[model samples]
Target: MWFERPPGVPDWSEAESYLRRADPALGAVIDRVGPCTLAPRRDYFVVLCKAIFTQQISTAVATTLFGRFRDLFPNRRPTPARVIEVLGRADPAVLRGCGLSRQKTSYLADLAQHLADGRIPTRRLAGMDDEAVIEALVGVRGIGRWTAEMFLIFTLNRPDVFPVGDLGVVDGLRDVFNLPARPTPAEALALGERWRPYRSIATWYLWRRGSVPVAAPAVPVPDAVAGAPPCARRRRPRPAAAPGAAISPARPRAQK
Candidate 1:
């Protein structure tokens, strides 16, 4: 249950009522989970970079790496300038020492460049529609459809943006619909239609019911790299708690 909701988060009361009326299956999920506690955050620059850091790595590696990355900037703040400066170095050891791969470092460079050059209108994202926000974000290196969707749900707190591609959502469908196996993306999208306009919240409950797949990169990747392919993930997808804390790859504010 939410002890406190930050400013402007839509009331879950209305969503809960509608979902309960619309689908009893999801209502069961909501009842068991208690309440939606998705606390969206600001600091778009930092969040975007966090998403990049999580690419193609496990949560433990991502967490430690992002912490070291914070050390690169003054006062442990990762401004665009700081990222640009550190990544600009000729030697690879600069970021590699933090366990970042060349691909991830390059992705971070692209993101920092976009922000520093005013490519992404971060301040205006709240006003943009879901598609518009996805468009703006995907233009940056490493930010893809899936990454944008997570950003929508977790960062902007959008009400409807269902991520059919997410393995966790599909796995949850297996439990909710009692399917023999995880639904295909197309199958998942079609099934998700029942929850329309509140799929994001419905998905939160689904995540509570199923496994949140380990961190996959923004770019296309094999299931092995992401830890589990869709068909096999249900066998042992990490608990939802892992993704809740590590999906973004951002460190705590108090990290010194």
Candidate 2:
């Protein structure tokens, strides 16, 4: 598991049982994928910053870069103030030396600034609902809806989120239903409502659905069923998906 399971997260045992009952196809996936492993870190700033470092990079590469990133601060913790101080420097060579791309550096700076200025008040997130948390996270420069949704699921452990634009979700859903083409965002949204408040758990299983044979998927896999892991279907990210934008909570309901 990338993160250690925090004590406050949902009851894995109960969630699995509920999900198994709510979504049978997903239940098969859960049986194949094994236990839910969503252990979230408590530090909001660090999670978002590391998310920036991880953008568009391989896992080994991201690991190396994050290690170098940790070297910049004492006790290996890049607190908001410490990161802000580093970004504020005229040269900022120390930060760039971590092998982060220029765009990623800018992203880190923006996130740190958000935390420092209270644009993203980490302390208040626990009290905020899912949409509110997404809004606050996407307000930071260089972050978009995909990142915010991931933060909601993986970091905050919000159980109901359904990231329709995520390739894993799309691919997983496609395979589960044996669809001829990938479902659009709106289509996925409609299909997902059956899972309701447990959609996040359903999503976790869907992410790994590609790796397992669907319990009762029909014969002859479609072109759309090509194996793939769930990531932002827009792997890097897409624009914000919020109420004010020309978008829904999922990706803008794109035309097929």
Candidate 3:
């Protein structure tokens, strides 16, 4: 059997150098997070199937459901024939209970049909560019830019993909840049240009930074005010105020 790495994959140092010059904020994050490597998969079908299983669900939950799906077909990785045999007459409710949304169920079924009909041409995807891969995969019901980008990253191991549509990337940018609001997809795409040719590595750092807890900002207490009377300390409010009472009003009443 022949084996090959996917196209557009850059060496780690090359990707890291590009990211380091792209943005200081992201460069710091990359330093902290270190290198990330894509998980290996034997073929496009397994990755696409996992992508279908993962939509709109937590990673843990997706793993559980995928485990069950895999258990249902122990002889081999899920093929269209095997999937149809297990899911064709199965209740939609049962599938939903397995954690698949209604739309995802439809998407999976459609994907299986396409695979069976030879419409997807999975082998051809490896040789295609990012845009071509997206165009091919998006024809399926549930696959969008994010999903296609995931396939490109994990399955094809493409080094330059940036999933600007991902909420994680948006949150990462907000945290790293201290932005007042999360960046929109267009904004992220525009901002990501500097990382070009290695956006995927930059994205991995962003994802890692987003997952780590940020330290709270240190607050400073003011030094004693000049000309303040020693008795001024006695004027402080007591902590025994009623639960509904205002703790600090905008204006204090004049002393009687």
lDDT tens readout by residue for model 2, 65-150: 89988877898999888987876773657666786667777778888888889989888997899999988988876777888888
Each prediction's whole-model lDDT (CA)? 0.71, 0.70, 0.62
Instruction: Please report the candidate that would top lDDT against the real structure.
Output: 1
What candidate 3 gets wrong by more than 4 Å, as runs, is 1-11, 89-97, 100-103, 211-256
Q: Which residue ranges in model 1 land beyond 4 Å of their true spot? A: 1-10, 210-256
Against the true structure, candidate 2 reaches a TM-score of: 0.78
Report the error of model 1 at residue 205, Å: 1.0
Sorted on TM-score, highest at the top, how do the candidates line up? 2, 1, 3
Q: For each candidate, what TM-score against the reference?
A: 0.78, 0.78, 0.71
Ordered by lDDT, highest first, the candidates read 1, 2, 3
> By summed lDDT, which 10 consecutive residues of candidate 1 come out lowest?
247-256
What is candidate 3's lDDT per residue for 184-228, written digit by digit as tens? 666667556767888877777676664343322121111231123
Candidate 1 C-alpha lDDT tens digits along 38-128 = 7678888888898787776766787889998898888888988888988887368867878778887888889888888877887788899
Q: List the residue pairs that clash in candidate 1.
A: none
